[model samples]
Target: MPRRPLLRNLALTAQTVGEHVTDDPVLLALQVSRRLPRAVSERAAGLLTRARGAGVVRALGHEMRGEREAALAALEARRGSPVHRADAALGLGRPDLTAALLEAVAPDERGAGWSAAAARLAAHRGDLEEAARLAARHPRNRHLARRMAGERDTFRGVAPSLPTKTGHTPAPGRVLHVLTNSLPHTGSGYAQRSHSILASLRDGGFEVEAVTRPGYPVQIGVPWAAERDVVDGIAYQRLLPARLAQGQAARLQQHAELLAAHVRRTRPALLHTTTHFTNAVAVEAVARAFGIPWVYEVRGQLADTWAAVRGPEALESERYRLFQEREAEAARRADGVVTLGEGMRDRLLAAGVAEDAVVLCPNAVGGAFTAEPEDRDVARARLGWDVPEDAFVVGTVSSLVDYEGLDTLLRAAALLAPRCPELRVHIAGDGVARPGLQALAGRLGIAHLCSFPGRVARADARWHHAALDAFIVPRRDLPVTRSVTPMKTVEASATGRPVVASDLPALAELVDHGRTGLLVPAEDPAALADALARLAADPAERARLGAAGRQWALATRTWEANARRYRELYARLGVTAPVR
Candidate 1:
């Protein structure tokens, strides 16, 4: 026999043995193929990598690593494989593409994999009955069939049931908020917003209860188990099941079940949830099960955030399409929708949500942020910054993400450094992009002028804000940035600091150009430098903008005002709190 043929047979035997011993058939195949001679191994592995049923595994691996573009490319390369194409389509959140891909397969060739993909796609598309029916046709799809059947049974008889008005005493105003994460675990802007809203609701006399799903404080390595804690007078009930943390689908189903049980016990008058499709889906399920009216608070265009990291081409990818679809579906199903800005509300309206259904509850400042201004010199001293009392300080308290345009800020700082030697930039938040940003600062020769204090504690966040002469929000002009407002900007404005931000709709809504803060063209270091230089040069102007900003924030962006808006929204939905 030819050496190649003999090696191929041996490799296949090893693959079969490996598959029997290990659960990962793809890894086994790759491992076995490596036993062949160099040239043969390379050719065989390359062929197997793009094999009919292997694209799903490869794509999933890429997705797990946050390499969305790579995952899509893997699926795109295997377009001829129905299973791969269906898996890709489903992953992208495109049931239509999945259906099309599966339909293109010959009837005889539609086996377990194709049936499983079809079933999952049906389930994702909110067709649990069809999903269950399709899942039953294949033995391998039994688990998925069970889940689909459970979901169907869970909400089978559920419908919203509002109390009829009687002359009897009114029920306590109680709300159950389902969140993606909370304090002492994650402190992203989403978590901060959730924390602020919960606190405001509680202080406003509504009994607020919050619950977070599994795998929260994601990078913190916390165990998967239930936890209870209170922060700033709001209680959080967490359900972090180990199995749920194993996968996204399992997390959603298990979270819904757990949340429904909590809802039954709490008997909240209404359900409230925020951000990302996952939280909305889980809360929507629980709300439906209990027949409770739910509010979907669209915090940010999460799909655009996910796409921002992947690149411009990601907007056209299946994942982006699915994200938008899921968000729109959540909005359509919710009794009311709340968003961060008018721009976002407009986007939701354009996406077909009823004009009245969407409410604008822009990001607001807590008391700690809007308290009487602290002395900047004292704050700087407390924060351990050794600088001249008159030194020009420009800083931001934000997660160092790419879309934040911190690199652009660094470039701007470098440009201003030549003229303003007393200038210093302090960034007080940490994220995946921090290392790259720091490297960029060093490359720009502004490392000496830049200080990254990592993530500041929420309680201490105001101190950092108070230490700045002018606060900056150097965000890029991305879809997410344009539609979504940043909580930091509100916090900065409330701290009585002038904001210098990109000229985008969302920031522009918050910072009235030249009145509240300076507006600079986005992604332009020169423009940002000019703005920073002008602010650094004129203390009177800075004081003027800062004072105006504080007034604006107090009038429109305080948590007290935000709470009133929510109360009104709830009243419109026939859920009202008793007067204090």
Candidate 2:
């Protein structure tokens, strides 16, 4: 094989192995380099002696270390490389420099990288047409261009406007939601939250509609249906094409066009989308076409979430930068912005969104959670926990993902095992990290104390919370975790269970430290263990905290309350519907 292809394959293999084996980027890179043929390795080392070559590697290394300025400096040193120049310029917020460098590169040489960078620059500069044009140059980016256009008029001519309400009392104007995924397919927190929001909106007297993107629930194959179906009383219109062979951009265009047709047929007053920039892009196009305002509900900083999983270097990756820029652009363009918590709102404000434009509609409780709390012993028995009747069960019902810090919980459990011999830890939920967490539990000698009952059905969510004497949110201190308020914590509180969570800003917003729940220092097993031990030792304190938490959740964190907030926000944006 040729050197470039061989090196590329080696790099990919190294990355795959590194991800599966360890978290160290330097080690991963070294492993990749070591796998190269001796001659190739020597040549690679030689290139590093050159300023431009050294600059390239240094930039990547600095980015991985979260050293933004250092990465820029390294990129600056690589003046001969147009790609590095563009990246450095973009990082410094100099779109003029970025565009110049991008334009200087040949189209073929530029490939998808230059196209993506130029498209992002154009979007950042508010040249949606130019952005779309540039994005269309690459197969992977075509979807982004359509999203940038968002039904807005270009040289391509104007899009059709949605029919407006004729009467003062128009039949509750429909609000169509664009989603990445929804119920009867995926069971992630994002999907559940979308279902809750949509249900609440429907019950609030508005005709709410949802359309999921293509290739959803990719893990399970389900036949596509274009016709609208009423699932659990909420109407979902499926728009995914039966056969999708076109590139992502073309698919996005198709989605927008189809959604536009749906909008005309439904004549919704506005559009709404959540989480990702891709969803916003598609909705923006359709909304713009119809001249309808749209709302952008940011559930989490997905870029940060992705970076946290990959490593620090991934934060400064081009993809991460583009994701952030796109999200910022969407937030800037949307008529309203809704986020899950104050921490997320602060981020939006810092990103230049007006304070008044952002609404803090937190995750909330409904369904079984709102019903009277179930007895702990009864709930535990129902879940088939073979524990002593007097044993203290400390557990959490959450997706067993890495950032969730379940390993920390296992470590904490180990520390508390000897002190609180009757302590049992139940982790209810399944994810990629389950095997690793289970292994960690065994290594900590708390495997006997820890129980992984896999994913609990949504219907059984309340019971899962009920079974726990105390719930825990042991999320590590990552930018994403710090900004996101976990719905699990709120749900646990609503179930009248005291929460033991990491002392992060988002959690602090929900759990009133010593009042509603105990807040321990993040990533510190000792602190976590101490808090759990304290809660385990005092039943009266647990009851007191749980009662206060339940009252707080009832007062502030109900889906009804969240719906009301959305209603008020919509009204402010001139979308009015009569109260039922």
Candidate 3:
């Protein structure tokens, strides 16, 4: 996090742009716009426009101009230096090209960049041992070093190292949380859930505070972030450092030190952190230092989520194997386990956690969501989204990721366009997949009826929820989707909108097949279309289902209710915090 020299910053900017220029054009543009000056951006946009063939600068221009395939093609075709060509090939997802480039040189002769590319190629090919060895070759490459050291630390495990105070009494009912990121800066489901939990707990009268990972919002593109922000009455503490350590083990140790200092100052009775092992490492270390109990919430199958994007075969990869091994290790070692639902709870229990240790606190609604939803016409008018009176709107408000299977919704829209002229598609929210999904809708010839209104701000979420007649959760049948419950779907139901979702275990727990909402086979556009068509045709049935769904959410899924359960669970663990 230290201020870099101008030359160093320039070199890093070039390296970063070159690294993602081919496969992730969006990433390249983001980097350019955020890191470079307007003059620099314009120059980059036309750097190699006239000079043809494959080169990083030319590829940068191609990516800047939104020519993805052409940028990748340029990366794949003409190249000079083995390091540059290898990096380009790796970016293009062509490990074979990287292998060919490296074959001409000795391992000792290959420079740092080539070694890094070789390591990535090895990881892509599932050779984790080779990846590790290659990672160690470039000791100065902090990114690879961090990844390498993370695996080592996960195996060695996180434990207490700092000394405890002789006579420091903790606030009896105080609880401290360690988080990766939080609101006003990040608006992902994770951030929203964290805020809801903290806010509800605060309302329930337990003194609660959250500390983000060291160098957080600052690290994530916000350089002017303050040291603390009180969001909805909960204090979100920041541990901003002038510079983060280089390797994962070092960085984790530094984070633990920073948190330990805060823990000493706050003196909380209990510590808490969510899934994925790194957070647990620091929390575990700090909890042990203070001789206090800690709870680890298993939010999702993070390893499965990581592999879900790579492909089915990625489950066999070294990184995936190590990720699960480490996560289970952390979960088992925690003082208590809290999870979303049955699927996730079972995974933790199967991983060696005792049955009595795990508690289910499913995703729920609170605050604004508990209120009655506005009429569709009223909501549409307020949001400035025009819609005909007869139009039947069906789409989801979610993070538009690939695993969400939004393309399936686009295809279903195409199928329903002819028979149901009033059908309209308005899939809200944003992510890397939005551009691709929009293109898919265009290709299917449903672009005229479909609307990709981009990211819907959290404050405006209720309006979007009220504007739709039926909400669709067309998730792909991936391990991640099957286990991870979505917060938006529950919010939709709480808005009195009937839900139509893939027949997955996690989602099945949320929707009561015939009563609250309908569950269709995953990835089946025809089945999804049929379900939506029925809802569109029968206004009464839609009302019945929507009302029933709202009742179910009210009865079972509320942050206030979840907060009560959390207090009960903590009491069982000897965290005798006074609950109002």
Highest-lDDT candidate: 3
Local accuracy of candidate 3 as per-residue lDDT tens digits, 302-371: 8888777667678887778878888898889999989998899888888999999888999999988999
Identify the runs in model 2 with alpha carbons over 4 angstroms from their true place.
Answer: 1-172, 217-220, 224-227, 578-580
Backbone clashes counted, model 1: 0
TM-score preference between candidates 1 and 2, better one: 1
All candidates: TM-score: 0.72, 0.72, 0.88
lDDT of 1 by residue, 321-355 (tens): 76687788889889999998888999999899999
Full-model lDDT, candidate 2: 0.74
Model 3 accuracy (lDDT, Cα):
0.79
Which candidate leads the pack in TM-score? Answer: 3
Clashing pairs in 1: none
lDDT of 2 by residue, 1-580 (tens): 1112333333434434433232123333533443454356446655543334546566544433324465566655634567656754664445566777777788669876677677666655545567668777878665445555542232122322333323322235578888887786777788888899999988888888888775343313343322455678887666544343243455566667777767767778888999777677778877766667899999999878867765565565545666677788779888999999888998899999988999999999888888899999888788787999889998889987789998888889999999899999999987656655766786678888888877878888899899999999999999899988888898899999999999999899999998999999999999999999998889999999999999999999899989999999888877876665
lDDT of 1 at 496: 88
Tell me how far the alpha carbon of residue 129 in candidate 3 is from the true structure, in angstroms, after superposition.
3.6
CA lDDT, candidate 2, residue 157: 28
